[model samples]
Target: MTDSDIGYLTPVIDEDGAPFWQYAARGQLRIQACASCDELRFPPRPCCPRCRSFDSTWRRMSGRGRIWSYVLPHPPLLPGYAEQAPYNAVVVELADAPRIRLVGNVVAAADAPLDSVDPELLSVGAPVRVAFTAASGGVTVPRWLLER
Candidate 1:
């Protein structure tokens, strides 16, 4: 199957994560920060995990990070993902917030196919920068690209 034949999955936008997707659509990466403790958190929650405060705010991120870990799914676990076998799924540790890690794919360009990056080139601790891709259904996804 071709890349066009396989559709990208849209993230489930809830009250806590709605701002994240909204910021991504605008080409800015924002994560939840605790208003009370000034702690940054990912996979946004209504309450701060650090201080248990219900008050939180959105903070723009540097979008610079390093690959903490990665995997090449050989037998693609999902239906659409099977078409993009050998693609790298990476866990990136943010430069400014080392404790905040995000999971995404590393591609050659913003809109490049999932398999654009060679799996051999990916390594733990490799520097990467964020890039956004507008997928089907008007959803924008944050992807990573190797930093030269």
Candidate 2:
């Protein structure tokens, strides 16, 4: 990876999130869905909060959402994200799950600098959609931006 390249180094899949990451590697966005109540959840887990059932499935999402909240960090950022300071990180409300939201980075384009989006462009309730970014190790991450 080059110094200017900004992205996750390796697949960070935990015990509960392994399936989600594995699916994302194939250009799919899989989120946890409660088998009982049919509730959609992000950041996969073993048990559903709504139904409290261990039974869940990997459901593909439309990859479309609206910007719910955003933050442009000051100079200091947490570890790996520090290099991309001033970047807009947002919580996106998926249309599929009006109550659930996913966190993602709002960027200009796939090839554009990760930190290039100006703060003026971001606003609450902005319409945004997911774009799966291809990366090494057969990983595809959902990067967000204004829907075109």
| TM-score leader | 1
lDDT of 1 at 142: 93
Whole-model lDDT values for every prediction? 0.89, 0.76
Off by over 4 Å in 1: 1-7
Worst 10 residues of 1 by lDDT: 1-10
Against the correct fold, how does model 2 do in TM-score?
0.81
**lDDT (Cα, tens digit) per residue for candidate 1, span 15-56:** 899899999999999989999999999889988877899999
* Model 2, runs deviating above 4 Å: 1-11, 78-83, 134-139
Per-candidate TM-score against the hidden true structure: 0.92, 0.81
Error of 2 at 82 (Å): 4.8
Model 2 scores a C-alpha lDDT of 0.76
